[model samples]
Target: MNNWKPRVSMGIPVYNGENFLREVLDSLLAQTFEDFELIISDNASSDRTEEICRSYAAKDKRIRYHRQEINRGPAWNFNRVFELAQGEYFKWVAHDDIYAPEFLAKCVEVLDRDDSVVLCYAKTKFIDSEGKILKEYDYQIATDSPQPAERYRSLVLVNHRKHAAVEIFGLIRSDALKKTPLLGYYARGDSVLLVRLSLLGRFYEIPEYLFFNRDHSQRSVKEKQVQIARGRTIVAKFLGMGPLPPTEWFDPSRKGKIDFPEWRLFYEYFISVKSFPLAVKEQISCYLYLGYWLFKNWMKLVRDLLIAAEQLVRASYKAQKIIEISLEKRF
Candidate 1:
């Protein structure tokens, strides 16, 4: 690793992503903006991922690849790249996602001109596994508001039907990002991180559709739900600790009784407001909005709990059937 610093640091965290890893890297390498370093954090992938990354690194000095000895969860790998970044601006790139050649250049230009904007991302175009264009994502969060409270409301209160967390891939000021907790080891961790960022500064959206987010069966969100169903606690595994309180879900320092992720998100937002320089009335207004959000999502929360219980019942039935078949065969 050389000491040369780049204006932008693009981090790609992957595990067993050899299928589209080359295409992702090719897109990054062909960027119009060349003053950047590509950081690839391989989470001990057992596939040909290591080989592909190593080959690319050998050819391009701008690419620095690091392999973990053990397979950590996606959250840890995602944050690991940021910890290893040494640039003025940073962006997280998914292994299966493709970017336009001018994606980084346009984002960098926006950030260069705007001092108040902490994050800058282009509009998104969803694509299938075969690279065919799906439809354009239309959900928008009001992150460009000059008022911190408005930005917080936009990020936390809005309900996006599709691609809700795509803005997490945007280029961000390193200083602003360093101040906030990177990513939690929970299901909606990316959404929570975006909320924290909105509390810090405004976000700028580039008008062009330069971001290509791929949707497939093997996406991380689906894989996480599968792991949860298999009786694996992702947060505990990622932290390398036993079960923790709900407070520690977002704040690693605190130990309190268990709570839902949505409640914890509100708690995090309150903490952010308290930590920053907001007026007394503005702080109250933000808290009021949090209360309203809770009221709005209460039905959804109950529905989600019912769905979770149904899934648990189904999994238990499957396991019991498997055991019964084994016993019959032994007899």
Candidate 2:
């Protein structure tokens, strides 16, 4: 009897997110846009997450809940939701974020009107755990530029401290999004996803601030704090002037491995440039922009190498200690 099709499919990937899950579900269910389907992918949460999702799904026909048998990383769960989506327009909703009632209606309107615009999002404000607005994201990227290279360049040199590139959470044409790798299991993979998407088509940002990003201790970017609490790391000791980026948050399997996150960004950006079908001049311009990026991030690039060497050395020492203990036990 279920023959209804939705114009938009929204997916929320979550893990142990009981604290804010109810509020997010309420906001989406209240949205002015009624044709959208809501998909929740639970990453094997041990909390009351299952109970909450099941209860919501029971009440709403639009809500679909899928629980993982085992916890993969956030990136894996993010992709899982997209795979399950059947709508023309797709949105990856964060478990902790809130949206205004008109958020989805406005985005779908823009996408419906313009074929060139591949993604549409509203301006965002950062909110604290108590739902108080901390500040608006005033950072601008010329994402609406008609030229692909110009859009790509605008996203490449972002002041991440000021701009979160939250547009990646926006409504995107499923076809355009499918062209780029849907978020990778590497650090800063979400950033790469936005940058690459800019090459495919223009992005539209609604003037009003309709997206509210939640900032709390449980957020993934703050997962570094948990790592720091365990002990000092090669990245913290040798790398200069920053908190450790959340590698394990993207993929828990990356824990204790030697990772060149900055280097990976450089590689992926280069690949994005090479793979796209842009004019020769625009392609050259994109490469020049990357050169500028390397000039700015050369220090971090070097740090990646240093951190890798230190990690390898520590891993070797640990392995040697284990072998010695094994020999003593045998004797």
Candidate 3:
């Protein structure tokens, strides 16, 4: 790549993504909008990921591939691509997802005409591992609202998994993105980031379904225990707290503590509103909404705790059984 700058920067953060990396890259390369730079941050994949990326980089001048010396977690890898981006608009592409050739062109057109729009994404269709269209996903979050409070309420109160958080992969204004913490190293961090961006400006959604999000078993959102562990690791890294016990890590009863991921999300939302410029009425309204949000999600919090407890009990029972079998064999 020369000293040329592009209007948009597309970053794909992959880890051991050799399976669909080529297909994703091919889709990106076929984009009608060619004046964009594609940055691939490989998280030290031991698979064919490095080979595939390097081969593409050699052929395409716009493609820049960087391999980490060691594997950083998904959060770091995702943020690294944006940090190295050199474009007015930036987007994160998942290696397993497919984008239509016109995805970039349409998103760029929207962002160009609307200065008030800080982020733009198209409707999403969920695809299976075989690339078969599963269903069209309807993420009914109110990010499109002109009112910041409405946007914030939708982002903060709505269940992120239900909404799919597809907007996290949308084309974002680099300036607006820089103003907020890109992504925190916690579960549902993408949702919190979206909330922050909604506070900054409105999000525009293309009516067409140009983005295809692949839903598979390996997706991070599907792994509840893994998410808990990742959130704990992040908390420990930042707070200088030694590794947290499993009980403390996933317990919603311990609100206001670093271990509670949901509480941390609300705290982040509160900080975003407090730090930003808002009218007194808006501020009061947001705080009131926050209370409403807590009240509304109280049962959901209990359900989460029950699920976590069930998982823990199952794990402990499995461990005890394994030990018993081992003892019986020894005897």
Q: How many clashing pairs per prediction, in order?
A: 0, 0, 0
- Candidate 1 has an lDDT of 0.80
Q: TM-scores of the models, in the given order?
A: 0.81, 0.94, 0.81
* Candidate 2 residue-wise lDDT, 1-331, digit = tens: 9888899999999999899999999999999999989999999999999999999999999999999999998899999999999899999999889999999999999999999999999989999999999988888789999999999899888877767879989999998888888898876788889988899899999999999999887787445774464226656565444533646667888776666778888899899997778999999999999999999989878777776676788889999999999999999
Which window of 10 residues has the lowest lDDT sum in candidate 2?
226-235
lDDT of 3 by residue, 1-331 (tens): 5589999999998888988898899999999999999999998899999999999999999999999998776778889999999999999999999999999999999999998899999999999888999999887878888788888888877864477789999999999999988887665678888888998899999999999999877664424554455435333445443321322322224423334455556678788888678778777877888889889766545444544455567678989999999999999
Q: Which candidate model has the greater TM-score, 1 or 2?
A: 2
Assess each prediction's global lDDT (C-alpha) against the native.
0.80, 0.87, 0.81
By lDDT, the best candidate is 2
Evaluation by TM-score, superior candidate among 2 and 3:
2
* Residue 268 accuracy (lDDT) in model 2: 90
Which candidate leads in TM-score?
A: 2
- Candidate 2 accuracy as lDDT: 0.87
- Model 1 off-target regions past 4 Å? 221-224, 227-259, 299-331
Encode model 1's per-residue lDDT on 37-61: one tens digit a residue.
9999998999999999999999999
Query: Model 3 compared with the native: what TM-score?
Result: 0.81
Better of 2 and 3 by lDDT: 2
